[model samples]
Target: MWCRIRRRTALPRKLKTVPTTTAPNSFPCSTAANCGKKVLDYAFQRGLMHPEDMGPMTHWYSPTPRVFLEHFKPEFMVQSSNNYDHPEQQVWDCDDEKNVEHYMELTRAHIKHYGKGELFHMIGLAEWVFGSPEENLATKIRVMKTFIRHLRREYPDAPLLIASWDFMFRWKAPEVRKLLAELDPADTVILDYTTDSGSYSNNFVNWNLPHHFPWIFGIFQAYEPQNDLFFNFDRAEEMYIPVQDDPMCRGMVIWSENSHSNPLLEYLAKRSVDEPFSLGQFCANHCGDRAAAMEGLWEIRINFSIFFRKST
Candidate 1:
């Protein structure tokens, strides 16, 4: 039997009334303007980005953040933590002064060349904690805390965006929550929730709404979740469909690596304003195998701008 796929409908032109409950409600959306700009404005007002220009189209190619910043001209920069092969090493082996200075040099270079007034969103990838099997939860917390504290001391003005997988619960699982609470909320925004199927399923089923932890509002959502490689929008829809009613989910970051390989980009491009109460494509970055073209794999992340009306 073929099952019918239910697609989301377009949002209203305006949210005349705020939602009073968890049921899906309609809101006014823009039609004559750019939806991307609208979303970016929201992100900026909420302090999601240091500057107002950042969007999904922002690219970060090696060498340095120069070309990426200059070309993409993103108002925000997300700096992820290094994934350590050996998890046991909490403290760096290199001298603190040298390592700190080294990082400062890189930051200074990026700032001096491409970013003068731009804001950075520093991220702590959850993979770093798993590096040490011998380390307990307490150790992990200590490590993250110290690292964040150091980053704050080094870059006093830059904002920090903490990247973490659900690990088990919200990544803000009790102990983790306590540790994060110690940090200033203005300086940190937790990028919780995940594109991983295992984590998504656990969190979705256990918690009535997709959001369980209050500290985490922003999310890193993968359009598709499979083999930790390919993200399928079909999969993402299946996982997210059940919880679209939750207002706590403020915004999301499309998994950059997965967005390029999927058909969702083209699909969204073809959608009309009458389509759904979802983001229409604002910015997109393509992703694929570096060496060879992979069949049926098109990775790209897009920021939906459902608020704007089309210009005739």
Candidate 2:
């Protein structure tokens, strides 16, 4: 029974190859999964939040340092304030070279975790400079150049899209536009504003600064895509409803923290055909003070079956 001696078959080793680089798709929004939920859905339907928004990217919804980069997801996200950190509350000055370098390292970590090419439309401070228009213009230009210089060195391939000043355009449009034009051709940046006159007041969304929309409109009309375009949804209820009227409504910048922060959401939930919006204690502007408390006291109560592993 000397069965024909079976020759030991040898398994071949897998070959290792270097990874190839490919450019990112410009229009990454085709399927519903990729597009996720639209802002109108969030407003009108009171829909459930997507996993990515609530997962590791939750930091994008918070107000803190290095958090500015968290909104870099390909889809739309809104934030309350553009304030990076309370630099005023710092024990040691952060503007110093050493401190800036340290923070820059932290900034790199944020970009690594969050997509680097995402656009951020923020409110509160318009005109990248401080002080009067005349003095601030020059200083803002210099600061922008320095900031861009740093970004170029670290993230040469990534783009930094910014809306310089949505509210202060009346005072700082011309110079701001010029500076934006001078930015690297590949850099993504755009200034934005609320087009509706009613945005100035209302319980849900408020745009306190008036008389600046004209200047902002002019810039938007003339803007070329050498940079990015963003829409700040600080008061989304008022902004999104009116934005459908404008032909140039391209990108959305939303910053609603709590359901209460947006009165329109409440209205839509009560009347709309979609999901009901929760009357939660979510203050979009200052959730940092009470985020932990809210999480503990109130249950978001979403399913975690897929995300969890069964214990043996």
Put down candidate 1 lDDT per residue, 1-312, tens digits, no spaces: 000100111212232132322224643223312343454456557765432111111112112223222332323221233432222222232124443333344444333322343444433323334333334455455545655565566567765555545344324345454555566665655554453334433443343324433223222434444322343444455555544554444444434334343344443333312244221121122333332233223233211211111221
* Model 1's TM-score against the true structure: 0.43
Estimate candidate 1's alpha-carbon lDDT, on a 0 to 1 scale: 0.37
State the lDDT of candidate 2 residue by residue for 145-250, as single tens digits: 5555665675576544444333344333345445545665444434343332222422112322122121122112122211111112232333445443443333
Those runs of model 1 whose alpha carbons end farther than 4 Å from true positions after fitting are 1-91, 94-98, 116-118, 125-136, 153-158, 165-175, 200-235, 238-248, 258-262, 266-312
Model 2, backbone clash pairs (residues 3+ apart or across chains), number: 6
Model 2 regions lying over 4 Å from their true place: 1-87, 90-99, 112-132, 164-171, 191-249, 261-312
RMSD of each: 19.1, 20.4
